[model samples]
Target chain A: MSMPKGSNIGQFVVIEEGVKLGENVTIGHHTVILKDTVIGDNVTIGCNCVVGVRKSRNQNMRISNSSLDPLVIQANCKIGNHVSIYSGTTIAQDVFIADHASIRENVEVGPGTIIGRGAIIELNTKIGHDCTIQTLAYVTGDTTIEDHVFIGPCVSMSNDKYMGAREYTLKGPYIQEGAKIGNNATLLPGITIGSSAVVGAGSVVTKDVADFKTVVGSPAKDIRYLVSKEVSEHDTTT
Target chain B: MSMPKGSNIGQFVVIEEGVKLGENVTIGHHTVILKDTVIGDNVTIGCNCVVGVRKSRNQNMRISNSSLDPLVIQANCKIGNHVSIYSGTTIAQDVFIADHASIRENVEVGPGTIIGRGAIIELNTKIGHDCTIQTLAYVTGDTTIEDHVFIGPCVSMSNDKYMGAREYTLKGPYIQEGAKIGNNATLLPGITIGSSAVVGAGSVVTKDVADFKTVVGSPAKDIRYLVSKEVSEHDTTT
Candidate 1:
């Protein structure tokens, strides 16, 4: 396969065959882009990143022998250092995936999302547009996050309520539009965060959160609202 | 220097000089082992791992010139993919460090410990034998995790109470023997988790946890008596 036009690659990069890149892409040092990966224009991937790898982790190990599909990175996305994007994933345009983030296989992340540093988006997750998953969050598998959601730093979502006893099928949270999960919150399996709901920091959410409600504490209970505020002091994407 | 006898080195591996490997050590693809690393017998390191590197991250960036010691990995350890172990650390035998686990420099991890997937044990941490640091947990710098302690998933421990304001000296928690920290729990700096105590899931611990007590919620308060269970259900090292 021929190299795409105007793609600048750094030292010790290993790009396998059948990988395609668009123009003005900057691939950083010590990156390994595996086969059947496609990159769009104006993408900048940082150092020590691994794109389209077959994941070997215990929670998200998926190595498909049946005609491996391509991992696609859309235009204007910025991938940070030491990131790992597995195969069978499609990142939409203008996404900013931060450093040490791991996007597992069969995931679909929509446009304008910011996956924060050291966050783990597990297998088969679907994240929609304008979402912000903050630093060190653990988003479990089979999750569906809708548009404009904000998952805070160190938020932990679980797919296994029984802790891998295999009693139930694994399913992560279904976060609706504009829902906000605070830092260090824990969402149990298969729960739904309603539109504009707020799960407070360090909360353990054991049930579904209704629309515009605010929940706090362990087995998070609803509290009366004091004041309405914007999601963050500053917007993530300018 | 010649390759170590019966050691299986993978393709495109970058091993520097004066690194010693024992018999039956299997190093996977795209791994970079730096100088002065000593790997013992029957060690299995997975793909894209960086062992014994001079770390570049903040709070662990110690490229020592005076008395630069080698990183030592003892026998029968299993290191998973994309893991990073910094220099001047010693990992004892039969430890299982899972995928994306980062152990920083000047640290010592004892035998039979399970450093779980995506867990980050920061600089100068000392973890004893039979400890379970579960998935995505963040053990901050200068911590001491004693034997038979079970630190749960996404448990966050901090060293800097001043939020990097440089007011007080930084120190993480000292978790004593047989302590159990539940999922999404946050431990404040310079605190002590006493022996056989249980910090409940999603709790924000502001002070020291007493022995044999169970603490819950923000500024965690204790509940009444519960039977002390062993931290590990089964022994990690047979």
Candidate 2:
């Protein structure tokens, strides 16, 4: 194999043949880039991160594993160290995945989304563009998060009514466009947060939340109506 | 620094000055043993695991970054691959730490304890000998788990009550000896599980459990008496 002139490759990096590496892609020490993984231009992969590694063969466990699908991170995305993006996850252009975040298999994160540090997105979730999933929040399986939504820190989204035992007939909950979920909130399965709705912090959402309304408390009740137009006008003036 | 004859060194593993490796110790690929981290004889470190790496310089993240503590895995302990045993975690002899488990700073696992795969034992939590923590369980800060305790999979032991904007003191919980917690259970803070008590699956324990009692349901109540003597006699006869 011929060497590239003036390229700094760290120790323990396995750059397999046919894997494309963009210019100025700096992989840190002890990081492993497996075969068939593609890196875009100017990507900074930090120390001890594993990219393109195969998932562990243990099926009975639900802990984070490397994805089998081809992971594609678009140009100019900032991926922090210790971030494990499982297989079949496609990070769109200009996305920022913070440190210690775990994105499971087959997730389609749209462009301009910012996944906060230590946030866990379970398998098969589809997040739309420009969304912000905050720190320490958990979005469980098969949830659909629309574009421009804001999920606060430590918010929990559940997929099964019975925790990991009874599978729900329907898929998990859906959060429509422009909705905001507060910190430490819980969203039950089969529920929906309507467009522009607001869920209060520490609320356990047991039912659907109507659009432009703010709900709070356990088994969350509608507290007040938030006028979207008035808020937009206030935003425009400010 | 003179090279010893017939020494087997794995690729990308850096053994700095003053570090000692006993004979027949197998260092897997990409595993870094930093300065002054000692490995006993007959130790087997799996692949892609980082030992004695410097901590990230984040101060307020609840993760202790000072490497003032050295990780000492005693002889004959079987540590699985991809396990991150941070600084200050001491694994006694014959301890079995499974894959993907995170033993954070200042934690100690007694000998013959099997920490299940993907279990997160937070800082300052001391797990006694012969205890089995099941997969995906989270044992948080300052908690003490005594000997022969079985914490089931995905069980969450919380440290805070009156959560989310409530002004309450956050106290630690205690799990006494020979307790068994079923899968997906939640234990509130400051509550003690008496010796040989059994908490059923999917139960949320809000109060202390009495010794040799069986508890079930949400906000778990006492269901029946756990016949400890009878069970012990059956075990002896078998």
Candidate 3:
């Protein structure tokens, strides 16, 4: 129930006790900031957002009642409307999370990331700096994304091989640095997208994509090398 | 505000003036119904929903201050939690819109249409009766979906050719009757899916699909005819 100095909160908003907010924060209407949450300076949260909420739906979630580290949002972040950000997550500075996006518990998102509208980042995922997760994309649980990665709209990355039965060791995709995944692409579980690789739109990547390669179509065959000097020169000329 | 007989309104529900509600409607907590909205009998609207909202952000939208038709929802439709339905939309009877689904303005959804969880139907789309739009699917604007069409999970339909550059008469894919689009498939703009056509999982449909054809892969080639007599005979024999 403690409000930091110079912070502006909108109507019908609820900020519980032990929630630490920094200066110059603007919280929009109908937002709920739960207990043990922490926000840094110059943050803007839009309307109808639920921050630090517990994952009540997942039966297998590693939910702890013991005192733990609060959900943290670093400086200069913009959170859009109708977003649900769960507990035990840390978001770095200069992050833009757009409307209707959901980020589950135990996730760490690095600085300068843009999570687009309606995107869902599931539990236990770690996304590095300068990444772009486009609109309506799904980054499944336990995924690891390196810096400068771009995931286009409607991209879906799965984690579980055997869906919803007895759970095996559910490991998601590992996307390396400078990788680009185009629109409507599906990455199967435990696969690796190598550095600087380009996955074309609507590709179903079943196996590991090699570095500097472009993959397309179902089961995603390697089409061409992505990082030729001629290609860079051609781009500069264009 | 006129309360119809035998309707149950939950806590924090906001229904504006000139909104007409039918009998036995159950509106959950924190749901907002704007002005000029008309609701039919036995409709169950879940929590945290925003209905009949105008698209305030689109500067190119056809916004009018004059009198217009109210947003309409017919009887016995179940709207799930956290949904946003815009104005100038009509949802027919027995339609089930699942959680986190967003239906935009000027859309007409026919009876018995199942819009699955997290599906987004863009503006001015018309979906016919008994159509199934599965979870996390995106139905782009200016689309026509016929009866008994099944769009599987994570399917994406795009309406742009130039993609936010100069728009070329943006029209989405037209899905004919009994067409089935499998999981994670993508449909490019201005394409027609003929009757009883089946698009395989992870397919990228760039052209028109013929009637009764089963297409697969990127640029979706026809792999087989769906309605063979031998298949029907085998099914009956089994």
The models' CA-based lDDT, in order, is 0.83, 0.71, 0.85
Q: Sum up the clashes in candidate 3.
A: 0
Candidate 2, after superposition: displacement of residue B126 in Å? 2.0
lDDT of 1 by residue, B115-148 (tens): 8779999888899998888779999988999998
Answer with 1 or 3, whichever has the higher DockQ. 1
Docking quality level of the chain pair in candidate 2: incorrect
Residue A187 lDDT, candidate 2, scale 0-100: 93
Specify the poorest-scoring 10-residue window by lDDT in model 3 chain B: B58-67
RMSD (Å) per prediction: 9.0, 11.1, 7.8
**By the lDDT metric, which is better: model 1 or model 2?**
1
Best by DockQ: 1
| CAPRI category for model 3 | incorrect
| DockQ score for candidate 1 | 0.24
Best by TM-score: 1
Candidate 2 — which pairs collide?
A67-A87
Query: For residues B70-131, what per-residue lDDT tens digits would candidate 3 score against the true structure?
Result: 78999999999988787788999999999989887789999999999989887778999999
Between candidates 1 and 3, the one scoring higher on TM-score is: 1
| C-alpha lDDT (0 to 100) for residue B124 of candidate 1 | 81
